[model samples]
Target: MSASARVIRSAEFQAERAWGALPVAELDGVTVRLHWTDSPYIWHVNDGEEVFVVLDGQVCMKVREQGVEQVHWLQPGDIFHAREGCEHVAHPQGVARVLVVEREGSV
Candidate 1:
């Protein structure tokens, strides 16, 4: 991936209540979000650190590994930090826009 950033980390766009998220692409280990609504996105990890920051809407997330899984409620202006090897499912409750940055290593 290139080093130039297209969408800034904290930028929001088009205020609307969306029900699902459409993926944009990956940038420097982070996933560029371009969705209108909130949907559950899964992360199957094998040592990768990720940063999930809401630029417009909130995100509901669930992480599962081995025999453990947990849920979360994320609002706009909220950031979720994830370490490596964490499997998760994320779904926001409203029209949510988020910037997901992940690195190939354990945090």
Candidate 2:
């Protein structure tokens, strides 16, 4: 890695097929990761807050709230924030890239 400050080319980040997560950087109690997915992830709750940003393609975010399930369709540039204890899952329509910011080691 270069020692100088730089920019991250979100579109060019490393990703193969299905779902993949590549760590970009880590901040105090936070981790930034680039994710690529073509399928839905299992329902889960984060240990802490999560900021999910769609960089490319589309995603359907399934969130459970007050005993009800809500679906949110996300496009490029859309951002979805999930607070801790918010059960949710992400379903990518096809090949999609997302930037996620959350507590380190959270799931």
Among the numbered candidates, top lDDT falls to 2
TM-scores for every predicted model: 0.59, 0.89
Structural RMSD, model 2: 1.8
Q: Which stretches of model 2 miss by more than 4 angstroms?
A: none
Poorest 10 consecutive residues by lDDT, candidate 2: 10-19
Residues 5-107 of candidate 1: C-alpha lDDT, one tens digit per residue? 4544434454345433345665565555545554555566636677877767667788886778788888777888777667776777755677665543322
> Cα deviation in Å at residue 96, candidate 1?
0.7
Root-mean-square deviation of candidate 1: 6.0
Q: Candidate 2: TM-score?
A: 0.89
lDDT of 2 by residue, 1-107 (tens): 67867677867765676668888889998999899887888999999999999999999999998889999999999999999899999999988899999999987
Q: How accurate is candidate 1 locally (lDDT)?
A: 0.62
- Candidate 1, residue 45: the lDDT equals 66
lDDT of 2 at 67: 84
